[model samples]
Target chain A: MDRPIGVMDSGVGGMTVVREITRQLPNERILYFGDISRCPYGEKDLETVRAYTIQVAEYLVAKDIKMLVIACNTATAAALEILRERLEIPVIGVIGPGARSAIQHSRNGKVLVLATSGTVKSNAYPDAIRSLNHNFEVTSQACPAFVPLVEELRYKDDIVTGIVIHQALKSHMHSDADTVILGCTHYPLLKESIRRYFDGRKAVIDSGYETAREVSSLLNYQRILRAPEGEVTHTILINGDSSRFKYILRDWLPELKYDMKEIELKV
Target chain B: MDRPIGVMDSGVGGMTVVREITRQLPNERILYFGDISRCPYGEKDLETVRAYTIQVAEYLVAKDIKMLVIACNTATAAALEILRERLEIPVIGVIGPGARSAIQHSRNGKVLVLATSGTVKSNAYPDAIRSLNHNFEVTSQACPAFVPLVEELRYKDDIVTGIVIHQALKSHMHSDADTVILGCTHYPLLKESIRRYFDGRKAVIDSGYETAREVSSLLNYQRILRAPEGEVTHTILINGDSSRFKYILRDWLPELKYDMKEIELKV
Candidate 1:
């Protein structure tokens, strides 16, 4: 299908998936929606997240999207199944790809999952990992402050950040897990800090890169890949400010030129 | 006048000013515009920032605002003059208020300015301070990474944050300056960390609060203060995702309720 692939996230975290899709399927056009207004969906109730997800999906479907990528972990956990059943297009979530990567990398059979409150509460990673291999042991930790900290760009702050990260990781450090999964996409930006905290003792897995690879394979499997062109124009829509988003994006995905557009998502 | 005052910036940095305005003028209604889509006007060239400021000013004028507040340092530096010339209503930039605060608070003549590139490059603070009293020595530093760091919420992150903050403040630490002006709104969020780093040796001035006081004075001088009401609703407009903007706003300004609307400022 020549129609654009629709991707939606609670915020910029989903850009990781978009970055991947663009790389894997160079020719495909993507319509991305970053719901920056009510982001950090990990802390919200599941019902509210599901409703928001449905609203975004419906909006994209109206735009005639060929596929849907629920780039947000919380939304995927809360609404992916219903979204797939309700929509005619294939709907993919970040969980399965992340789980698969964790399973592949876990040599000790013990895996630690770090995500937002909603994703941890949903037990999505554990469930997904177990579905693939029942023998794999999964431990989940909800880093509530991580999303906000990342959004506020506090990744490098030493004193306060050290305390927060330490508090969040204290349990995982004592756990029997040797492999850790960055369940939330936003967590990837803190990979270096997280890795340092782990001090080479554990393998840190970035689900974003793996999720991107999964998206590539899926497009190839379905034979829906777009051909690479001379110049690809990426449109970034934020319900809020696009300045910081654009800045980080330039650092994260340097190839594509970003043109930010502001849109109103109805309450 | 019944019309609300219009305040705008590139992103959440303006909230510092908005917070003060709300506190000082509880009866007044504010229409705040955070152009999250094209935020951090500090890095952009003069022409781009000027155009963006005019665009936001025009939008606010269309809403029948009584006055306009350029809550962003970059916008103020690049476009305050043009805005005052072009717009019929009173236009206020953050630089003057900040400079005034620095001057009043400083026991010693030495004052340090920490702001974005645009503000530093424009030399607005020094010029404003010198305009008041040329004898006062003004030192300005352009902290380019500070906005992004604050936006990313890196204040809590220990190692990376410490490095960035230390680097930004290194030169100012040894200076004889008794007062440091947070020339950018975003700098306030890093206040605690900044304070801890400074160890209370120098008093920090928040431009937002000072700007709010200026806005109030301007309103009183103009005789356009609105009557106090039982309920005051703030109408927020974002060119991007309204939800994301609302999420950040709710966090930034918890006391104020926002009725968000989506707008397109493509021209």
Candidate 2:
């Protein structure tokens, strides 16, 4: 019952989800993995991305986590089913929750999905949203620059960040989408800019927040929630470099005390 | 994959969940049972409630449902864990989803739970909300009269209905609760009146809608979702008189085509 919940992403982007999980389920311990060695899974083909994701997931599974959360949209679109089929514990992904949130918020039955290129090509958000609600009209935009902006630590409210987001969403500025699903975990780091770029008109749905709520619901329903008195720990593993990761973690979660390590994954 | 989802409630209160399920997952079939013979499980002791819920769940499990949703809050508070342990399929409850929704919606930490006397006596809502996030300040008000208002078909907006709602929530008019949780399934039917009573100030949280969103997420994650091409069916079972149930179904779901039957449970 006190087992750590494993969270993984292509790179430091998944910290958005980890941030949320810490806030929502404070009693639970977290084991985070960021594959900085392969930071951009969004540009790869589905088969390659699936293989890389499985390697990362297998590493976490071997550590005996109680649950696994695929915090990367590209990885979730590629490998969530396989991981769930292979893992004994509950495996949750960010796609379904974001799609559900978009459905919940979109009053006009029109939604805009902002994601990485791989996720857009995979059509996971549109499929997930339309499956739950057929009447919804979905529009997907691939923000290839958005992830780079977050990963390069350029997510500040500056002119360059504004220009990047504006250029990415220039076409849908006047679209009828009442809800915007932040389909990528890293996109939440750029949430303020994206919202401002849209002039705060559309509801920006955070995949990490929705995913954290889903995790809480499933854990409680499964009766596997950690006891309130259990000791909480956070362990972060990065495949490439730990210096930048450490800086980002400290900035995003100033109060979170955790161990950061750099390791070479066999993958 | 075409297996139906089983939903059980104390009585017509569960219809709220069924309505949401139909709207959210149109391809999925529903098998619903109402223990109208013992209509109000809210007043019973915990042991009695548990026994009655298991009896109803076992009946649904025998029908080979792929999933089980405990639509009644009191029954969920009492029997969700036991049923999840005993049943082979996925079991979902309204309490966790409601609690999660309140956590997601409340701008302030203060929240109000509107439920039956048995649910408040069980201390389930407070425990559920606090377990997920300790910062929340929960206030539970047992509106025992609320259920009867819906069950006796006195939910219509009239002088009596207004008086009942006013008296039920009289003490909390000036309270600091920023969110109101409709802990009982039947309470959503009285949503408009409740919101009006609060003068559209507090955010009204519908457990049925939140639970339905969770059901969709779980089904998609488990890969048990019905195919888009699958022919959908709705079946309703009641342990006692069903003429009233049938009328309510028609009124609540005007376009739904369902098979209604009355049968006695051996319990």
TM-score, each model? 0.49, 0.93
lDDT of 2 by residue, B94-166 (tens): 9989998998778788999999888999989999989888878999999988888888888875788899988
By DockQ, the best candidate is 2
lDDT of 1 by residue, B218-249 (tens): 46434577766567777777777766556556
TM-score of chain B of each: 0.95, 0.98
Cα lDDT of model 2 by residue, A112-135, tens digit? 999988999999998888877787
Clashes of 2: 0
Candidate 1 C-alpha lDDT tens digits along A89-148: 777888876776565556678999999999999989887666445668898889999988
Most lDDT-accurate candidate: 2
Q: lDDT, candidate 1, residue A17?
A: 77
* True contact recovery of candidate 2: 0.58
